[model samples]
Target chain A: MQSGDSLPELAPGDLPRQFTSRAALQQHLQQLFPSASGALSPIVGGWAAAQERLAAVDPGAYGRSRNHLAGAVTHLSPYIRHGVLGLAAVRDAVLGRITRRPEGEKLVNELGWRDYWQRLWGQLGDGIWDDQEPLKTGHPASSYASELPADIAGGSTGLACMDAFAAELRATGWLHNHARMWLAAYVVHWRRVRWQAGARWFLQHLLDGDPASNNLSWQWVASSFSHKPYLFNRANLERFGAGHHCQGCPAARRCPFDASYEALEQRLFAVTPTPRRR
Target chain B: MTAAPMTATPMNSPILWIHGAALGPANPALVAWPGRPAVFVFDDALIAGSALSLKRLGFLYECLLELPVTIRRGDVASEVLAFAARHQADGVVTTAAVDPRFRQLGQAIAARVPLTVLPVEPFVAPEAGGPQPGDLGRFSRYWRRAEPLVWQRFKG
Candidate 1:
């Protein structure tokens, strides 16, 4: 992985003309990264290494291992998020190397989701804010803000998975795609924290923090953007994070759902229904 | 030269407000004002173009039409002074700006009119409740059973 310090700052003259296409952008990148070593040595080095690893590996393994908290999945989000690697370029490179299959299509769909969110942002400038429901009127026992600092930054939340996520997000500025969904669901449905607070916390810490994806994804889990809400159980946590060694999760016994490892494995690995906009 | 006596003013002129975000969520309180001034929202194309989003520039032009009370987009203070001189406006009311230039504009406008910068809280999403074991199993089953139908709809 490339460290933030290793990347060189480009002058105005170095930038490409506006409205450059993906192919043209790639050509520009090639010129920019001319030799094996350049000012962008870190980016080039990271991209080359990632591409090599991606080419040789079986992405099917990703479907099974993507949820594990350990180093079980590829970390391509940062590279893609920063515009260091264009989506089209990555797609072309991946397609060239791997046979197009259901698993590959799923990965591609994930990338397409990123594109969808950006386009949606362009379509709705502030409507995203407009659709927001006001915090329940009349004083509730607690406000979302009260729990935000501890659950997000302090990582003092009693939920084992939630605390682990907070710690990891603070440490690395990244989280697995699935883990993000799980975290958002747990926070909104289980912890009852407001989505906006969670979104802001994510943005403050995430290196790949994007307004469209982060905001909309939070909305989706909160059931604000969709008709139905998403909820997770303790078993779901155990299956995905067995190796992480979490401590004192609140959901262990108090949870409404079963926490059995085998039950969770069957549920998570099953050919499940894809998420949809309600 | 002898100055003509100024006549007492009639009712306060309504102030038209323009913004890029949705008025309801961004500024709910504004909706309650009795003035109920006309609102002109710029299209996305106008807001997204150039250094300043088209929406912002459109807002500037819209404010110009309501000169005197016209709330200028940049350097609120100067814009207010300029509008006051040109249109003889009663006063300017405007929302706060994040950009330094706009913030300055607010200060400038405040010099002339009764500018109010309303404070607001941002919206947030709620957390998920931990589901029961049977509910978890049901949700999983529901997800699996619905996959084919959802995919078909997606493809369509």
Candidate 2:
């Protein structure tokens, strides 16, 4: 059958037939559907594997360092996103493991963020694509570029952190939450691109990409869904990013993000007073 | 002391609709009705229209390998209904989804066949005896009301 054919014929035998080896299946898929020949890794996809991943989440470490580049972040998002692992099951696993309420709270709270986004998506419907609230940033909402610039898409942006992030997103299909925030901010705030443009780009690459979570988060960074646009400075990146990208960056001295948060706030939000509820 | 008389209803066997939102054995819908035949559709129109990448599709392909599911491609609702008819299923059972597109698909399917949606298991629970809140704009406010109830069902 053709790759895009509407109906695939089922084998006449048993259900849940044993799948061929990962490499073999991948090879078969590659030849049958040549377009899917990216650096896609077939992450072991089942309940047993998800449970194993859930068991390894260290809530305490995650709570303390989740914002850092090398934080103890749980990598179970792909599993959770696709329903291989239910959200409640993961919450139970974390709560069951960590004795301290405070430690577990952060991880649970993060999960709650996912729930919140899904709830919003349900309530808003297609409206999630539109700004929930008016743009609070200095620039008018209409002024934002609808298409992502070639530089950003190609990872040729002169900025060191952003280029690294772009490359990481393409190669690994994942990024830390903090990295995501920073990249989204730069795309919307600095590059003058719309959140939708960035959101679409992200959806194409992320393994755990969900429209509710991904689109809503982009809107959050754009200040269209939140009170203020999120912006970060060089110092924040250097501290949390582990400085690997900075070490090899050619723009180390004349960094675009050399200013403080206040300076950035002034530059990006010039003339516009601290965003008040419309 | 008394039991209602059993009536012959049109709905009997349930066919699991393994949607993109819930794609594996842990799916609550699957858990509710085990050993039932399952169906998955690779909607070309949806994939072609959206920014979904080949890698994401590849990931989904991998996930389907773990389940005893019949995979197909076409309009989601039509394909699902077709599968149900072929399997002699009286109704379709699928995991609840918050995505609007999925809801639309469910409604479309329901128009043609009986559709039952199971709740997404293992997340924050609704407030006890309290009305389900509508304000989802911020996380902090939502969590304050939801925190106490998230683990309400936990046995640990």
Candidate 3:
């Protein structure tokens, strides 16, 4: 935060040492910046690995099932976020594979979302940290807690799907886009935690986390950037998230999200749609 | 009108500034000035005081190994200035960032030295005639304007 003349004194031996392997580096970093609970394994690094990953993205399959838990999601987000693979390079790779433009439209559109978030940050500056618009939902902004609950952070929320997502995020440093949406919704809407709290927690863990994309997306889920608060139900979860997290979930019968979307919407918001002010 | 892109040319002295978001070979700034001594600093004031995890730091360390970047630690702007002065570099160049903090540091660096900010390679290019970003609030609106030329490959 300091400039040349007003620089603060850095601790002795603050420079990063030459790391021979990922494990060595993780171990060294642990000595300095310890993680909250579980730590993430090192993802594949370098441009060669990133390019190889890029080549493996099947746009057709991605468009078909990206929302499902078991989907053909291009795990290229971490690389793209870190600048290992440039955006143009990924687009070219995707476009070269599909025969028609529409074949890659969904994937391309998703990429555009990343750009849109970046553009907003460039325009908004620190405004991205605050609520962009008034909450369209009935919930008041002041009513939400500014910090995440210990139960949610510890991945023991008694909600199987949410806990699994938290565990996966802690272990992998990545999550599917749909999974991210669900997690944010659960945190901000269901848990009533501030978007900033969830945003910071995600930034702390996610390898692909960018303040613009991550925070703004969280805001969107919280109804601070979007027209309505995003919500999901048991049926929706079962349709898209039934595989791993739901397989042997002990909390299956006791699931809090057992109702339908409409029921939950009525219960949570309890009002007519707030008309857009064109 | 937008100024002409300041393409990095073969120069006697130029330094590349690689931060959290700009840390790889594909980095446009590093690509623009290849073979220059790039420096990645772990801003102590920032890292020690924030919720930065060991995983991110480790990931950054792994990425830096693949490039010829010299890793340093301390105040970001100050370290970059010292690194430039120590190497007696005439100018600095880096990838443009949307992060306000990064942009603040970039502006500070530009005020002191010749800093060239290069655009990141876009995933999708804007169409010749389209609505500006300010006009759009939702992703669907932005996509409508940008999708036409975003993936359209130019024919020779």
Best by lDDT: 2
Measured against the true chain A, the candidates' chain A TM-scores are 0.66, 0.88, 0.88
lDDT (CA) for every model shown? 0.44, 0.75, 0.74
Point to the candidate with the largest DockQ. Answer: 3
Residues B1-156 of candidate 1: C-alpha lDDT, one tens digit per residue: 011111223325434333322122123324334333323222223222211211123222222222111122333244334544443445433332222333444454455555445433211111233221233122333333333322332221
Residue A262 C-alpha lDDT in model 3: 66
Q: Is the docking of candidate 1 incorrect, acceptable, medium or high quality?
A: incorrect
Q: Considering only N, C-alpha and C atoms within 3 Å, which residue pairs clash in candidate 2?
A: A6-B73, A16-B68, A87-B122, A88-B122, A88-B123
Model 2, position A186, has a per-residue lDDT of 86
Taken in order, the candidates have interface RMSDs of: 20.8, 7.6, 7.5
Show model 3 residue runs off by greater than 4 Å: A1-18, A32-40, A270-278, B1-11, B154-156
lDDT of candidate 2 over A142-188, digit per residue (tens) = 78899999999788987789998988888767889989998998898
Candidate 1: regions farther than 4 A off: A1-57, A67-72, A130-151, A243-278, B1-156
lDDT of 3 at A256: 68
